[model samples]
Target: MADLSIDFVGIKSPNPFWLASAPPTDKAYNVERAFEAGWGGVVWKTLGEDPAAVNVSSRYSAIYDSYGEVSGFNNIELITDRSLEVNLREIEAVKKSWPDRALVVSLMVPCEEQAWKTIVKEVEKTGADGLELNFGCPHGMPERGMGAAVGQVPEYVEQVARWCKMYCKMPVIVKLTPNITDIRFPARAAKRGGADAVSLINTINSITGIDLDNMVARPIVDGKSTHGGYCGPAVKPIALSMTSEIARDPETMGLPISGIGGISNWRDAAEFISLGAGCVQVCTAAMIYGFRIVEEMKTGLANWMDSKGFETIEDFRGLAVPNTTDWKYLNMNYKVVASIDEDKCIGCGRCYIGCEDTSHQAIDLKPQADGTNKFEIIEEECVGCNLCQITCPVDDCITMERRDVGQPYMNWTQDPRNPHREVTEESTHEA
Candidate 1:
């Protein structure tokens, strides 16, 4: 089996899987259990100043499908309820007990330098491996001008990150908020502040649904519901896009990134690494399944790595970044035509319906002389958009074939077509 060990900012872990700063890492007992379950590290739940925060009893709600599958997760939950003293003690205890496992404490307080300075002094004394600044919580803390509120403002993100770097001796990771207009802004700011790494994304602001009969938002607290953070599988694409944006952007290029949000399995972890995340964090996935899910994550990643002949995680990390680029840079001359495997076609007509109505009229569907349905591609008319390939239910049934760009006959690039272009003899002599 391939080695699954990873080292992030000098903090070594048996694997790349770390629990996010959520319920799973709220207390010492919980974090210990996570480590025992095969997790390589745990970012203890967000802890703040002396005054403890109180959370609603029913702070969590679920968006379930007809099959009772959890399509999404909503939480009005705030940071840790425990005091700084309790959290530090637990961090110290856990670190001493499991010295090999990574123990990073997450913190969020007032953005002022004094507030950050005081907390960092105390947290560093605990001897935790690292620290993660909690700038992504989008719910209860935003009202205090913390969490997403601070994260949304690029200036505040930079200032707070700088404070952490100045005050803390350990590695500082800035956890980014997904509620912002553009994620690259905060990521770039964090890197400017000397952050060891950045982790994303915190939950997004959302109201899952209202109880129509009672006319109430979800997780009704005191007969009223405010917007909570949304997570789960639904947010994976959003998280991936933001991570890829930060990874590929010129401003924050080469910065270490920790991927979070909707990471449920080894495949998802591999995708995150391929997209430039050095490590992967999990919360909702472990909450949905048990902590034992890490066992599968470890084994699966190891097995896949072995099969691919990758000796270590770094071999495959950021393997896909070079292929990602802006749309304007794309070569318009490149083209692809759709091809269908006759034996593999399920005849679901989904591609036909999608292409015939919504997309470019690329597919030709008609009845054969033998009273059988036949689907063919109109090569001349096909724009090669690949909508049919996406809509096809069967795998490999519809494939896109790349068309070679032929020599241009229009001569648009020639001097004749340009205003600055002098009408040369060849242009003037042409009919």
Candidate 2:
């Protein structure tokens, strides 16, 4: 049997799926419901000192797909609007009742060492499993010089992380901001400051949409709007790329990652784990579908693990990292051409139009005897870009067939067309 449990940086959980700090984990009621619904843990919404954040009435908006589904979600909401005493009391009660589940308290405070020191001590008294330093909130908190403001500066990230570790006995996981140019810098700094692990990515800065009549960005408040953090299925690709970068980078290798951003299903969680994340966090999905979504996530992941002959999460975790390499190292001699299954073709000609107008003109349309159009791929001209296949209406109608060119494996560095080919010591000696 496959085991979904994980002990991330010594914080034990029933499974790897933990709820990221957000509205879903805002209070004891929500956290308790999430635990009852099968979530392994919850990173309690970011706790701050008194004078809590007062959010706007309209706090969220979403970008929708053609099918009217939410492709991306945006939020301008700040940290916990509740007072510190209220939040701390709830956190302690929840952790006490749910002793087996991981309860990590997400926290944000002023950059001052004393602020961090004081907050860490108070959170420790709650008997939570760990702390996720909330340095990733992009919109409201940054204006006060706390969230992305601290995350964007490597020195500040390190200094604050150090302060937390110095005063707190529990493990500290730094939640990183995605608004930076390079994620590795802050990740490396967190490690330098002795962080136990790191979680990402917070959210990409974005404006969901604009109301033409009002001329304001989405989730408008009193006829105005500000940029907010973006997440959901649309941001998954960006999140994956950033996660892989931190995983493979030598400076931050082996640092435990609690993957966040657009992780809706088990496959998304699997992808994050394969790229070196020890556990995965969900926020937008739970917000959209409610807590019961974790049931499908757990079932799907276990089924996948069993199919792969794996007994535990560790068996396949980080297994894909080595294969995720740079394009420069890719085999240039490998050839694949598009193959259209004529029998299954619906003659929609969507593939032909897509290829002709936007992509390579490799798909040719012809009037068939049955008075319908037949689309065929020009094998020689097809570069296997998969654009045509993606536009095809029928599933598996068009496939990329690998050509057995009998050519040896060659990368751009070894190719004759490369003007700036890498020169080895042997080449230097010959020259």
Candidate 3:
């Protein structure tokens, strides 16, 4: 069996799967159950100084797919509503009991230096492994000059992180928000302030959908609604892109990452690690399915590592970072054409309709001799966009086949078609 344990930024855990600071880690009861279920670590839910931050009745909304499965989730809930002393006591007790498991406290107080400094000192006595600065909450917290409000300003992010680093003895991981336009800015700011690592991303600002009958948005409270923080499977692409952006940037290079957002299984965790994350955090998946999901995540990841000849998590961590690059560096001469298997085609006409109406007119419907309709791709017109394959009902019926064009590598910077090619060449020659 491969070793699943990881030592992330000096905090060692049995595995890289930690529960994100959400409802799942809101209390000692939930965190204890998650530990028993085999999760490696837990970042206690965001704790703040506000004890009067009341929660609404209908604080959640969800987006479901055609089959009624939750594709995305939204929440207007605030941070931990419990008192500061009670949360601190629970953290101490939990850390005492589970000494081996990583217990990092997540904190968000008023943006003042004194407020942050005081909380950091209080949490340091809890015997916790580390602290995650929660500057990513997008919903209720932002209105009070916290959460995304602090994250949106790079200067504030740097200043707050510096305060935490100065006052706290343990590792400081800054949890960044995805609500900003450029994630790299905040990441670089965190690095400048001496953070041990950075975790991302916080939920996106979203209104799941409106209620057609009530003429109001979902999760309505007293016939009114406000935009909530959106998360879950739908946000995975955005999260992954941001993670990759930080991982590959020259300025933020070598900075540790604690990947969060939309991670549900072992494969998702592995992908994040490959993209340079030292560990991964999960919340929505555990909310939908109980903590038992960690069992599968552990077993699946171990089996995959064994098959790939990886003896430890570090063996494959950040393996894909080098391959991630800017768009201009992509190979423009690589060609691929769509091919359809006639025997497996169900004649759904979905591919034909999609290609003809929305995509390139590559696939056409033909009437066979036995009065059956068959869809065939036009070799000349097919751009290998994979639209037909995505729309096709039958799996493996449509596949894109790569064709060797035998052309040398060419990019926009050096391509003859570019009007600035002459200037680019002249600059290069001068250098």
User: Among these predicted structures, which one has the highest lDDT?
Assistant: 2
Cα lDDT tens digits for candidate 3, 1-431: 99999999999999999999998998999999999999999999989995646789799999988998788999998899888899999999999999999999999988899999999999999999999998899988889999999999999999999999999889999999999989999999999999999999989999999999999997899999999999898899899999999999889988999999899899999999999999999988899889999999999999999999999988998898888877655566778999999999998888999999998899889999998898888999999999988988888999999988998666656666778754344333211
Better of 1 and 2 by lDDT: 2
Point out where model 1 deviates above 4 Å. Answer: 64-67, 368-372, 407-431
| lDDT by residue for model 2 (1-431), tens | 68999999999999999999999999999999999999999999999988998989899999988999888999999999999999999999999999999999999999999999999999999999999999899998888999999999999999999999999999999999999999999999999999999999998899988999989998989998999999999999888888999999989999999999899999999999999999999999999899999999999999999999988898998998898877766787789999999899888888999899988899888997989998878888888898988888799999999998898777776678999998464333211
**Could you tell which candidate, 2 or 3, scores higher by TM-score?**
2
Score residue 198 of candidate 2 by CA lDDT. 93
**1-431 per-residue lDDT for model 1 (tens digits):** 79889999888899999999999899999999998999999999999987988899688888887799887899999999988888899899999999999899899998899999999889899889899999999998999989999989888889998998898889999999999889999999999988999999999999999989899998898789999999887789898999899889989988999999889889999999999998999999899898999999999999999999998999999988877766533444567899988899867788889999998787788887887778989888888988999988898999999888793322222334355645445433312
Supply candidate 3's per-residue lDDT for 248.
90
Candidate closer to the true structure by lDDT (higher is better), 2 or 3: 2
Better of 1 and 3 by TM-score: 3
lDDT assessment of candidate 3: 0.91
In order, what lDDT does every prediction score? Answer: 0.88, 0.92, 0.91
TM per candidate comes to 0.91, 0.97, 0.96
List the RMSD of every prediction in angstroms: 5.2, 2.5, 2.3
TM-score of candidate 3 against the unseen true structure: 0.96
Q: How far off is residue 308 in model 3, in Å?
A: 1.4
